[model samples]
Target: MPFYDYECAECGVFTALRPMAASAEPCDCPDCGTSAPRVILRTPNFALMEPGMRAAHATNERSTVSPKSTQAGHGPGCSCCSAKPSSRTLTRPDGSKAFPTARPWMVSH
Candidate 1:
């Protein structure tokens, strides 16, 4: 089901609803009981790439100095290792540290 955005003219209310494509054009406002105009909203579409396509895309799009590249460059059991302390600390936008306890993908390779 596709979600549609609508705006009520009478009550000046905006909302999103899952409705059929044909019925979305002239949907009524759920709150004010008035006819609302359906608006097209921006939605993200995600597609899964095959392993070969993913590898090719990664090779093309990834920079030479990415974190993964850095991790691979440092030999096994280094600070860049997923099991090390460096990987456990996640930095915030404001330069704060977030201590991650769960080692989801952390393993000494």
Candidate 2:
């Protein structure tokens, strides 16, 4: 059973659980017992939610519509996206460095 909204003339608005087949029909108000027409004003109430929960809901909704891109080359100077090979020099605390590559004549800066 799903919750449905019904507006009563004397009791304002109230919600009731009913089958999908009877969603279009009016439901009896719990307080007044009067038959009230089904309404569409029962949207999710995010205002009463906690700050963190509300923010998470907002982030989820945004990601579903316009998610952040994960493709390469987000902008200039991106280390992983650069074409040039990165340096692999290992240095010690005394400022001395060693190159592990096969180049024997390479000079240290």
- The digit string of per-residue lDDT tens for model 2 on 1-109 reads 8889999999999989999999999999999899999999957778989999999999999999976765534765666766887578878899999887738898877
Candidate with top TM-score is: 2
Error of 1 at 10 (Å): 2.4
lDDT of 1 by residue, 4-104 (tens): 67777777646555557555467777787777877656543324557787776667667554645445457656754467444766778998866577565
Looking at candidate 1, what is the lDDT of residue 56?
69
The predictions' CA RMSDs to the true structure, in order, are 20.4, 8.6
- The TM-score obtained by model 1 is 0.33
